[model samples]
Target: MNGSKISFLAFGELVVRQLTDFSNNAFAALILLIQDARTPMAVSSGGDDIMQSHES
Candidate 1:
């Protein structure tokens, strides 16, 4: 593969890894809050659960 092609693939891989890390961290935090008897709150950009909160 060309150098440019390899660079693009590496960039894409980094993006995917970052996203996976973020998701794992978010879920871990939620679990910790639940175990501590705190509210499992999450602030997402957009999702069905975000719109269907009891506060609304």
Candidate 2:
């Protein structure tokens, strides 16, 4: 019984650790996605300006 309890606790700890890591990675990816989204908008606007200048 004691051995089974110890194993169960270890499994729970591993699950918690994995969940923490997953959440951290997910947060980092979200931040990166937001930055990427902002960058494309800025770049597109800048590109349009360049195109207009060339046309004129």
Candidate with best TM-score: 2
Candidate 2, position 4, lDDT: 100
- lDDT, candidate 2, residue 37? 81
- Summarize candidate 1's per-residue lDDT along 1-56 as a digit string, tens digits: 69999999999999999999999999999887776554333433444477667559
True-vs-predicted CA distance for residue 37, candidate 1, Å: 2.0
lDDT of each: 0.77, 0.88
> Number of clashes in model 1?
0
By summed lDDT, which 10 consecutive residues of candidate 1 come out lowest? 39-48
Model 2 CA RMSD to the hidden true structure, in angstroms: 4.3
Which of the numbered candidates is closest to the native, going by highest lDDT?
2
lDDT of 2 at 32: 87
| For model 2, the run of ten residues with the poorest summed lDDT | 39-48
Cα-based lDDT at residue 52, candidate 1: 69
lDDT of 2 by residue, 22-41 (tens): 99999999998898787764
